[model samples]
Target chain A: MSLTAANIAAKPKPAATEGNGCQRFNTMPGNGAQPKTNYCASCAAHDKALCSRLTGSDLAEFGSMSQHKTITAGQMLFSEYDDARYYYTVISGDVRLSRMLDDGRRQITGFKSTGDFIGLGTDGHFTADAEAINEVVVCQFTVPTLNQSLEEYSVVQGRLMEMMQEEVINLQNHMLLLGRKTPMEKIANFLVERAKKYSGVDLDGDAITEVDVKLPMSRTDVADFLGLTIETVSRTITKLRKNGVIALETAQHIVIKDIEELELIANGEA
Target chain B: MSLTAANIAAKPKPAATEGNGCQRFNTMPGNGAQPKTNYCASCAAHDKALCSRLTGSDLAEFGSMSQHKTITAGQMLFSEYDDARYYYTVISGDVRLSRMLDDGRRQITGFKSTGDFIGLGTDGHFTADAEAINEVVVCQFTVPTLNQSLEEYSVVQGRLMEMMQEEVINLQNHMLLLGRKTPMEKIANFLVERAKKYSGVDLDGDAITEVDVKLPMSRTDVADFLGLTIETVSRTITKLRKNGVIALETAQHIVIKDIEELELIANGEA
Candidate 1:
C-alpha cells in the first residue's frame, strides 16, 4: 500500500459544506423532463419502497428534479466527498462507482444502470466518485429539495429507509464480492443480478421473460469492480462463452442462452 | 488468491432478503417485560431516523418485537445471504461485521456497538455475518414489521438512506485502505472515526466534545476490518502510541491524543 503525505494529516473539515465540487452533469441540464404520471405503472418492483406512495405533485417533484444528461465514456460525474450537490437516477446507460487510492490505483465499486440511484448520502455530502462506464444518461436532482420533501413526507422517508436498508445489504454484497469470491464467482454474481434486474419486457404488467441485458461496461471496468485484473475478467468471460451457457454479441451485449445453466453457474452448481 | 470450486455459486442474490439461518434467540423468557412504549423512550440514539419515528404503538411494537439474545465471542449472529428474520439494535457489547471466503479466510467489514442496528435489509435480507466480537446483547425484530414501519415513516427512510450511504462510502473508504493507504494510514482512519462516533457523551444534539469510544472489538478484528494482518494493526497502533498520537488505556480502550494528526493519517498525509 502506498502511503502519501496526504495520508499524513487529515484535511481540515470544511466549516460549511461548499458547492464547489458540483460540476456539469454529462446530459440535458436542469430538472427538465416530466416523467410518466405513474413510474410504476408497468413494473412490480416499483412499489417495494421508492416512489411507492407518490402519484401526484410529490411524485412530480421527485420526477421533475431529474435532469437527464448524457456523458461520454471516461467523463467523471463527480468525485468523492464533493459538495453533495446532487443525487442521480440512472435514466439510461451504465455509470461506474469507484474510489481512487492516493497512488492513483482505482477500485470500481459498482456499475449502475437504469433505475439505480447514485450519490446517496447524509450531511449533504458525497464520499466517492461516479463516472460513466459508457455513453450514459442520468437524471440529477439537488438534495436540498429532496431533503425537504423527506421531512414533509413520511412515505418518502419510508422509501428512503427501505433504500438504505437495501444499501447496507448492498455493501455487504460488495463485501461478499471483494472479501470472499474469486473473479469467476464475482462475474457470475454480477451477470446473474443483471439478468434478473434487466430481464424481460412488461406485457400488460405480466412481465415478459425476455432476457437481454446489454453490458455497457468493459472487461477492465468489470475487473476493477470485481477486484481482479482485466486479464482475469477476459479469461472468465471467455470460459463462460466456451461453455455454451451464454452467447456474446460483443464485449457489451450479452444473451444468456440457457437460463438454467446460467443459473447453475450463478449458483455454483456447475 | 485461492481459486476453488466450493463457491462457484454462492448466495446468488442479496442474502439478507432471505428468511433463514438465524440461531433462534431468547433469554430471560419469564421477564415477559411489557414492550417499551411505541415511542422507544429508553432506546439510545433517539432522534436518529430509526429511533425517532418509532413512536407509541410503533415504538412499542418495534421494541417489543425484540427477542433478546446473547452471543459469545466468535459465534456468528448471521451470515451472508441468510434470510433476515430480525433487524437488531445492539443493546450492549460489540458486534463485528465480516465476510468469509469459501476458502475460510475472512475480511472484517464493519464494527457495531450499542445503539447501532445490524442486519438491516430491504430487497427481501442479512448480506454479511454479524458476530460477537465481545459478549453482546441484541434486540432482534422481525423483518416484516420493520419493512412495514419503513413504508410508514420518512424519517426512518432518511435514516436508513443515510446509513446505506454511509455503508457504501465506508466500503469505499476500506477499499482505499486496502488498495492505496498504508498500514499507518488505515489505523489512523480507524482512530479518527472511532473517536468521532463513540468517544463522547450526548451533549446537546451532537455527541459530547470529550467522550471515549471504547473498542470492545479486538486488535485482531480491527486488523481484519482494515484489511491488514494482526501484526500490521499491532505495529501501527504501537507506533501511534509511541508517537503520542493515541493512548491505550487497555487493550481495547483508546484515547486520541491528537485528533488532527490522526486525521492527517486518515487523509494520507505523511
Candidate 2:
C-alpha cells in the first residue's frame, strides 16, 4: 500500500495544523481566536456549494468550523479505509477518487472538481482513496460539525440531500458508461462532461461551436476511469483528432472543434 | 420501447386504483377514509426500511399516504424519462433497474429487493427503467407526500440519508468490479453479493460453509449487470462448478459449497 502523510494519522486533526511539508492555511475565522473574515462571501465556490443555502449568521457559523487546506499535486488527501472524519468541498483544482483490488489493479471511480462535495455519503470510514490530481484547495469540515449544522439548518440539510441525489444520478450514468459504452463513445462522453463542467458549455443550452478543455489527470488515469487500456485511450483520441472533431493543444489540453459532432459520438448517434 | 400499463400514464396517480390488471391494494389506512390498522407493525420490511425510524401516530400518518402495488413478472414499474411520481420500498421479490444506449445496448445498474428504496435519488424524471424480475410487491408513496413526511420527521430524513450512503458505497464497489476485475472475479463477486443479500450469510460474521442463493434475474440480466457476455457468464459459472466452489441446483438456483474459496476469487486473492 502506498501510504501518505495524511493517511498516517488515525485521529481527526486539522490538516492545516499538521506540518506535512505542504501548503496549508488556518482559514477558520469568527471562532473568537481568529480574526473574523467573511470568508464565505468571497469564496469562488460559495454560490455553488451547499453553504449557499445558508445566509448571514448560519453561513458564518458553518464557515467558522471549516478550515482551508491545500493538497499538493499527486499527494493523497486520504486513502481507502482512512478515518473519514472530515468532509470537503473542492475550492480549486481536481481530486481523483479510486479503489484498488488485492492484486493492485486500480479503478478510478470519479473525479471531483471545484464546487464538488466529498465525503457526504461516507459512513465512519472512507471507502476510496482520494488523491489530488493537481494542486487542490478544499474547505474542510469535521463530521460532527457538519452534522450539527445539518441538524440546526434544514435548508442546508435539504441542499445536502439534493447534492447527494445528483451524485447518485451521476454515478448511475457513469455506471452505464463503464459497463456498456464503446471506447470512442467513452472518450467523447468524457470530453463532453469536462467541457460542460470546466467551460460551462451546456449541451441543452445555447449552441457553442468550440471550447478549450483541460485534462489534468494523466492518460493512465483516464484509461482507468473509462475501463480501457491507455493505448486504447490514446489511439481513440488520435482518431478523434484525425476526424477533425477535436484538436490537441497538448497531452493535457484539447480544443473541441465540433461540440455537436462530439456530442453525437458521445450519445452513440454519430 | 416496451411500455407497460404502468408507464402509459404521465401523472402521479395511485397505482392501486388504476385498474391495470395487476394485483393492487389500497392499504393506506388511518386517513379517515380507510380502516385504522397498524399495517406497518406487521410489514416484513418495516424494521429494515426507512420508516423504521417512525412510531405510533408518526408511522400511522406516514403509512396512511403509502399504497401497496404488485407488479407481475416482466412488467415495468417505470421507464426512463417517465415523470417521477412514486417512490417505492420493495416488500417482496426483485426489481431490476437499467439504462439503455441509443443503439439499444442496455446496462443493468442494480437489483432492488426487500427493504430496498427504488426512487430516492431521482430528479423530476426517472433516469432508468425499473422492471419486475418476478411478481413484486412494493409500498408506494407520492413524491410530495414523502417530502412532507421528510420535513416533518427528522429521523426519517436521517434514515434516508444513511440508505443513500449505503447505495453510493455499493455502487462504488460495483464500479471497481466492472472496470478492473476479470470475468471470473466479476461472477464470483456477484454471487457473493447475492449470497449475502438473499441468504444473509455475512462474510465477516460466522463460518457458514454453505448457502443457497437464488438467481431471480435472467442470465442476460446478470451478464448486463456484470459487464460480461452471457456466454462468458455461463462459462464462468461452469468453471466454478467444476472447481467445487459452487453447484448449480438448477438454472435459477445456486448452492455455494465453498464460500471462502469463492470470496477469495471475488477479491482476486486466489
Candidate 3:
C-alpha cells in the first residue's frame, strides 16, 4: 500500500489529539461562520487560512497587520538564506519552493497555491527559495506581527498548529514518492494530485471519468519535484497519453480521461 | 547551500516568531529549572519532550496520564492503518518509521530516538508503521488525554507547534537528499547526521577529527532509508573506508577519521 498524497491528506477523523481532526492542507474550510473584516471580506484565502479563525475586533486587528503583496511570474518571494522577515498565505497563483546545490542542481520541495502558507524557515532565514510560477498575490505578515497574533488568539494558534501538522504529513508522503516511486508512477501521481486540486471534484468514488487539470508550472519544475529528468517526465507523460489514460490539451493543460486507470498507475497497481 | 537536517535544526536564533528558535529534535535542554514529580524526575525524555512545559501540579497531572512502556527489538509500536489511539515520546532506544508498497518496496521515512515523538497520523489512523530498532522504552499518552493536556496548556501547544515546524524543515531537507543527492552523497549525509546525533560532540568548526558512530539499523534499513540498493550502500561504505575517510569497527560501528572530508562529500563538494 503506497502512501500517495491523495490518501494521506484525504483521511478524515472526527477529532485529532492536538486540534480538529487531521486537516488536509489547502483543503479545510473555515470552522464556523465568523465576521470578516472589510479588508479580508473579499480575500479568497481569508476563509481557508489561519486568519479565518479571527472575527470582530480580533479579525480587524490581525487584518491590519497584513499587507497584500503581488509577485510577478518568475520572481522570488524569498530566496534561500534570506532573512525570513515575512510569512505568507497565497491569495492566488502558484509558488514553487526549491533548494539548489552549489553546482546548480535543484530540487523543488513543494508547490504552493491558493490558500497555501509559505516562508517557513529556521534561524530567521528561509530554508528554501519560493518563486512565483505565475503572477501571484499573497497576504504577508511580518514575523513579529504574526507571532503577536498567535499569542493573543488561541483560535489562530490552534489553527496554525493544525496546519503545521498537516504540512508535516504532506511532506512525509512526498518523501515516499521521491525515494521509492518509479518515473511513470511519479508522473501518474503528480497528475492525480493535479486532478484533485484543480478539478474541483469530490473524487471520493472516482465517478468522474474526465477532468481538466492545469499545470501552472513547467516540465522542469515537475521533473525536479518528482526526482526525474525532464526527458523521463516527458516520455512518461507521452506513455500515459498513448495508453489513453490522459490527453494533453496544451503544454500547460491536461485532460484526465480515465482517472481510475491513472490512479492504478499512480499506485503501481497497473 | 544544501539544507541538511543538522543546519536546519542547528541554526540558533534568539527570540523566534514561534515558541523558541527552531529547536532541534532530540536536542535542546528544557527551558528552565522546574519542579519535577517523582515519576518524571528519573525519566530521560522528561525535560526534552512536550511534558517539559509542565511543572509542579501540571507536571504531576500530566505525568499521571503517561504509561511507560517497553517494546522489544523487531516489534511494531504501531502499523499502517492502525488506529492511532496513543502518541509516544521515546525515552530510550530507536524506532524506525516506514511505509511499504504492496510488492514489498519500503521507504524508511524517519528514525525516532530519545526525545523524538511518534504516532502522528491522518484520520485517526497511522500513515506509517513504527517499529522498534532495538529494545525501546517510550512514554505513551492516549489521544484524549494528550488532547486535554494540549487544550489546558498553552505552553504545550506552543512547543508542539515548534516541534512540528522543525519536523517540516527536517523533512524538506531529506526530500532534497532523496530526490537529488548522489548515492555517495546520501550515505555521507546520513553519516554526518549520525555523527551529530550520536557522537556527543559539537560539530561546529570541524573541531573533532575522530568520532565513533553507531548504526542501530541494519544494511537493509540503510538501503531503504537512502533509496539505494543494498549493494550500493555496502560499496559506498567500503569506498569511504578505503579512502581513509572512515573506518569500520564492526557491522554496526564506524569511526570517522576524516570528518571534514565527509562533510565536504556529504554536501557534494568533495
Candidate 4:
C-alpha cells in the first residue's frame, strides 16, 4: 500500500507531502532466496499477470518496475489512510483485503489468490486494509510508474479499467452471496468459482484435468465471507459431502468432481 | 424495469457474447418490455446507452420509437435469461436487484434509486431479477442503439467504465459491511450514507441541518441486506435511540440529532 525511499529512487527535494504516487512501498524477497530487484520471485515470466494482453517489451518494462515483495499471514500490507504508494499483484499464496471495526471485529472483504491485483483505490487514502492470508509473494509497482504506463498505453488503461470494473462486479455478487445466500448455495458457488480459478489438481502432473480447491480460510472466515455462522458452514459442507454434491478429500480440500452439479447446487437446485 | 412492446418501441438485448467495436448495431425501435430482459432500474442512464443518453435531435429521433412502461410494486420487471430486447430507465420509484433460491429464499443484491443503471450482466442474460419496490416507470431502448452508441463515443465509454467500476467498489464495500460489521454499525452507516445521498431535508419551511432518511425496505428486506435478523435490526434501532445517537419520529422517519455522534458510534465509539 505504501513504498519507502528504500524501494524508490531518492528525490533530493522530497518535499513534505507524502508521495501520493509512491511512498513507503517495499517488497520482501523470499527468505534465503536470491533477490532480483528487476523481477519479483513469484511474478517472473511464470506470473499469471503475464497472461494479460501486454506483450513483448511492454510486458518486460512492466515486469522490470514490478519489484518482488513478500508478506506473512496477518501482516498489514497497508491500512486505511496509508499514503498511496504501489499497486500490487499477488504472485504466490493468498492476500486478504479487509476492513475493521473499532472493537477489533474485522471482516475480510476479499482474498487475493495468485494473479489477482491488490490495491487500486483512487487519489484518496487507501480505503481497505490489505493483508496477507499466508506467506505471499507479490510484485509491487510505484504509483508514478503505474500512472505513466497507464497514460502512455490506452490498451493498458482500458484493460485496467475493465479489470477494476470486473473486481467491483465480483464484489457486488459476493455481497449478495454473503448477505442473502444459503449456506449450501454459498459453498456450491465458492467451489465452482474456486475450481474455475485454481484449475488442475496437479494429481499426476501439471496435465491433470480435474481440480480440488482447498478452502484457504477456516469455517469462521468462510462464515464471515458468506455472512453465516461457523456452525452453519460446517453443517452445510457436511450436507454437501453427504449429498455427493462435493467431496471432502480432506478437511481443507474440496473435490469438486462435478462442476455442472456444483453449478446446479449453487443455483439452489439442491 | 423495461417498457413493454406495443406499449413501447424499444427492445433489450442480452449482454452475453457482446464483443467490441460495435458500430453496426441497429437502433431500430421495437415494441414491449420482454419478461426476459434484465431491466435494472438503477442503470437508468449510461453515457454510452442510446435510449437513456440521447439528446436534442437524437432524443427526438429515438423518442418516436420509445414507449413508457409502468410496473407495480413487488412485480418482476425482468428475470434471468430474458431475451434482451429493450433497455430501460426508471422514470419514478425504486427497484431491487435480486436472485432467488429455488426453495424460495431471496437475496436482494442492490437497491436502485433514480438514475441508477440496471440489467447489465455478461451473457446478455440478466444474472438476477429486477422487482419494483413501488410503482415504477421506464423508457425502453433497442440493443442496437446501445451498441452503436458505445462504438461512437470513447468518452462515453470511459464514463461507462468508471461508473461500472464505482458500482463494483460499492459492492465490495457492501460485502465488507454485511459480512463483518455489527447490526448497529450497519444501520447507522446505512442511514448516514443515505443522508449524504439525499443531502438535506426540509422541515416546516425551516432547514434541518441534519436529515433523517426513511429506510425504503421492510425489516425483512433490511435483514437480508444487512445479513441480520429482523429482531436484531429492531433492537439495534432501539439501542441507538436510547443512546441518543438518533431519534425516531415515527416508524419510518429517523432524525439524526448528532451526526458526529452517529459517526463515532459507527466507528465503534462507546
Q: Output the number of the DockQ-best candidate.
A: 2
**Each model's RMSD to truth, in Å?**
9.1, 6.4, 11.5, 10.0
Ranking the candidates on lDDT from highest down gives 2, 3, 1, 4
All candidates' chain B TM-scores are 0.77, 0.88, 0.84, 0.72
Please report the candidate that would top TM-score against the real structure.
2
Candidate 4 deviant stretches above 4 angstroms = A1-51, A57-65, A72-74, A120-123, A147-154, A182-185, A201-211, A216-220, A228-250, A254-267, B1-77, B83-92, B119-123, B135-155, B201-210, B229-250
**Which structure among the candidates has the greatest lDDT?**
2
The TM-score obtained for chain B of candidate 2 when compared with the true chain B: 0.88
Candidate 2 regions off by >4 Å? Answer: A1-37, A203-207, B1-37
What's the DockQ of model 1? 0.21
User: DockQ, in order, for the candidates?
Assistant: 0.21, 0.40, 0.23, 0.25
TM-score of 3: 0.85
lDDT at position A214, candidate 3: 93
lDDT tens readout by residue for model 1, A154-184: 5655555555555555666666556545566
DockQ of structure 4:
0.25
What CAPRI class is candidate 4? acceptable
